[model samples]
Target: MNNHLSKTIKNEMFSHHYQLLYNLNDFKPFGVEILFRSSLFSNPQRAFQKAKELNKLYELETTSISKAITDIHLNSIQGQIPDHLFINVYPSTLIHDDFVKTMKNLIEQTSISASNIVFEINEEELITDHYSLHNAASNLKEEGFHIAVDDFGKGYGSIQTVIEIEPSYIKMDKFFADEIEYSTHKQEMLKSMVTYCEKIKSNIVLEGIETPEQFFKARELGIKLGQGFLLARPCPLEDL
Candidate 1:
């Protein structure tokens, strides 16, 4: 077989897991986050690491995005996919060569508008110059796509990124939700974050809410969006 066919076969082995993002106010569905999974490897990060070793990280990322568009279409699931699809991607993928052209090509083949696709950036990297993170975000924005910064308070992502990128959503890491009910400190920080997010026109997604106490605390802190075991668990889009 040709190299293209080999690569196609490799990417086709990858599939995606979906989780819902919800409206805290009305308890209605707001959107869904697409998490990439691979049958070949039990861990998703290991798949990406293997791709990196093979110099195929871009292909891996691209394939996942394409699969998300058709995931429900090809699945037995009867639920309509939510408009906003928050796709988790590496920061490196966002800055890859021809990334915009490639993503536009993938999105053009589908009925979904580019506006409905939000590229959620995770992992950490040193941001340098306007042409780095800023440029990647600007290019996507120009094409009607959106950006989201993942792992807000933990990992390498920081408040500076939120201020600089001004992403449409700020996903707080689950660490804060671990014991949120009893921690006045965590609650206070969340309240401050909610205010800060409002000031910049960004929504805060409080992740890892696994209990009523944690969920209630998140709601009381004025969080607008949330995702965790309490609301729903991650499952294959086919199961939706």
Candidate 2:
């Protein structure tokens, strides 16, 4: 990272950015994925990686959640709350004792419906303890909050985790979406995953779809929900 980027990340100059997930069948807004962005960085992923390196991932995740809830509350005042709000959380963060308590308190304080909040667990990190992960997921589900296994195929124990945690949604990884128009193998793989999701009765969301061809392919594969530059790009809450 450049010097300015380093400073910006350290100072936490990030703002909550949102990308709209659309229902492919009708092209209607289904939910908004909460993302963090900064002027110094093109995307939030780099800054998040830096935070993880510095052991500040938990702090950053909590702060982002608080801000996102605040944004949702503000939007609710204007009758602008979408069907759902998708918030990303690491498995490590979910396993922490304080995570669930803090989240519940925030939801209470903000007066946001727990049912409308979908916690999309980022599956990129290693899950050392499946039992703890399942317990945490169960607690959130018991509270009526939805759970989603994000980046499904790209992560460790993707299938086993889904079977153990039983998320309401399974997000197809972008790797399968990229250049899918030309690859027959990828198309077949996506079709198989869609079948599995159907068997499990879990909804699927295709991520990183940046082209019309990719979007159409996803629809052909029977994916109902999707997020990508072709559909909508990340923007400030005010822009929505």
Candidate 3:
């Protein structure tokens, strides 16, 4: 993968999950997107330790912070609660049969409706074989989970992955939002992507909308949903 940033700058990725809401005002509130950490592992030994600990607790094929999400959901079921949950899946692990089976069981046991679930795919890493990754995505789609291509326009496989996966949602990165104020080039790129997405039936969600100007700009571009500090920060489940 090409390092898009300077080597002097340290990059850190912390995985956190958030729910996606369609219509921003819908009662039933029908859609969700699970965000994942995009930065690569910093320490080999510590990463291994984290993975081993996660593997012991969850049925995921790999041990990583993402497993923490599955563990929480697997143990979250109790008396009456909402029947919706979205989880992240790394592109590298999407083809693991056991992991997928474990996910199916977790959703089933919790009685979570599949329609409200979304599998967010982070494209920071290049997918050498689009066919395999597309197949894995298609399998999850077959089971009724909405697909979302995360960090769109900020990764190596942005356009190709969008073409192949054909996710239900395309999340715009903060890079675009920050540049839209001064760059006609960025605005044109964004508008073209939105147009293509519409032609293919994909909804656009602008991530990292931090100011009123940003929000209105996205709205002007026909973006239906906007997420970021401007709208609402990620709150705890109880708070949400």
Judging by lDDT against the true structure, name the best candidate.
2
Better of 2 and 3 by lDDT: 2
lDDT of 3 by residue, 1-240 (tens): 123211211232334445435443332434434444334545433332354344421322233333434544544564323343445555766765565665576567544556656666756556787888888888878888777877787877888888889998888878888846667887787788779888999887777777778767776777676667766665444434
Cα RMSD (angstroms) for every candidate in the order listed: 3.0, 2.9, 7.7
Each candidate: what lDDT? 0.80, 0.86, 0.60
CA shift at 124, candidate 2, in angstroms? 2.2
Candidate 2, residue 53: CA error in Å? Answer: 3.6
lDDT over C-alpha atoms for residue 229 of model 3: 71
Angstrom error at residue 225, model 3:
1.4
What is candidate 2's TM-score against the reference? 0.90
lDDT of 2 by residue, 1-240 (tens): 445544654565678888999999999999999887766656678766777777777877887788779878977898788778999899989988898889888988876888989998888788889999999999999988999999988988898999999899999898888999999999998888789888988899999999999999989988899999999998888897
Off by over 4 Å in 2: 1-12, 39-43
Compare the candidates by TM-score and give the number of the best one: 1
What's the ranking of the predictions by lDDT, best on top?
Answer: 2, 1, 3
Ten residues in sequence with the least summed lDDT for candidate 1: 1-10
Q: List the residue pairs that clash in candidate 3.
A: none
Model 3 clash count equals: 0
Q: Taking the tens digit of each residue's C-alpha lDDT, what string does model 1 give over 68-93?
A: 78665444245466878898777778
* Candidate 2 vs candidate 3, TM-score winner: 2
